[model samples]
Target: MTATAELVVDAGRRIAQDHPESPLAIAGLTVRYGDKPVLFGVDYATPPGAMLAIIGPNGAGKSTLIKAALGIVPKVTGEVTLFGRPQAQERHRIAYVPQRAGVDWDFPATVLDVVLMGLYREMGLWRFTGARHRKTALDCLERVGMRNFADRQIGQLSGGQQQRVFLARALAQDAELYVMDEPFAGVDAATERAIITVLKELNARGKTIICVHHDLATVAEYFTHVLIVNMHKIAEGPVAEAFTEANLQAAYGGRLSGAQVTRLAGASS
Candidate 1:
């Protein structure tokens, strides 16, 4: 097998042996953006091979929680462990997919080029993309059903295609854990379905997946675990149990209309 394939297999084996009950364990995690507190004393654990959805209203710190867990954001106080190690120590085992809006789509790069960037950690900053890297990039695209568009410029693709390309890049990293932010935003139904399929496949392979989601309609269908948050963690547990009217009220602060609450509760059922 190729080095990339071997790495993936080894990670999979480690995941199987460890059977890490939690991909991320946060205790008293608090993040502040300048003087304003974002995440307040958040405590949660994301289990392996489970799809955990972080849901809340705008400025609820869902994204902040993910960033704090990844060590990308400065935390006021708290501890975050990934696979029982500091996030920096286990960086290779984790992958991240930021929202499409967070990227500069105007950059002059092809889909293949973008996906190949995932190899940078293994390839090193001074190294160049070689034949093996190219092959791996192609395989990543193929896994996402985007191999045919490898040569297409990123800016030329539609929003959904761009999202898929980003996902392909993340997959190419061969990580054990995936943290995605707003992955289903600005996509067609087909794209959403495709993303869901890939997420399910990844979970089945023993990879942990966490998504910062907005749509209240698909929580039950797409997520096994749910975390409702605003400035602090409101509720977290199995989707069927955690996504309740009371929890929504707490997260939304009585601002969510009764009809909206009913809709969310019904959909989560």
Candidate 2:
């Protein structure tokens, strides 16, 4: 690792020890596809009850960072912890909502069936879905305004409706920390508002949410903290402090167009 990478890793360790109550901590995270590295030593820690936005340009490894932390993709080197424990030990406390495009919407399953899958971790491998599980799933759907579509097939819903279904499933998990990737991408305005409202409610309840968000316009409005990355950790902290024009420039490498910057400034204002 380079000296900068070493420093980033060391800083992560210190932050983790100092803020031992953090819901998520990642150190020296590196991932490679074939011989090419996607993420070079990256480190980050999410403050308790924070709504953190992980943002960067296309191919910046934003999604890879989340996937590596969750062990969905193999990492070259890294340490990931949840609530001061190894992620494996605290898996039940974490909920993941992958990007919509990453899923096959045509899968033949009812909305209720998909939501009920979230309870499998609590139900154990041998237990079957029962009345209580069904009720919980229904309630989660209701929370996302999808209760009426519980019987609908997953492929039959619109993009926004599908996003709601995914969110409801995550709610059903009832995890303390939520890691979502591009939940707002391709969604209707109403769906976006609904997701924000639900996320705010979760934050109010002390649940930590970390989203790999693409929309620069909504970062300040929706998230409490921001993690800017372009192959490595560029900057991370409370949105007001860490997310700035300079940091955005550094992370985007001059690709953030003038209009986008203007919109970002307007949004943050």
lDDT of each candidate versus the true structure: 0.86, 0.89
Model 1 whole-model lDDT (C-alpha atoms): 0.86
Residue by residue across 57-81, what tens digits does model 1's lDDT show? 9999999999888888888766677
TM-score, every prediction: 0.90, 0.93
- Model 2 weakest 10-residue run by lDDT: 11-20
Off by over 4 Å in 2: 1-15
What local lDDT does model 2 show for residue 92? Answer: 91
What is the C-alpha lDDT profile of model 2 across 1-269, one tens digit per residue? 46766676676576567656888888888899999889987877788999999999899999999999988999877778889877789899989999998889999899999999898787876788889999999999999999999999999999999999999999999999999999999999999999999999999999999999998888999999999999988999998888888888888877988667766856675
Model 2 clash pairs?
Answer: none
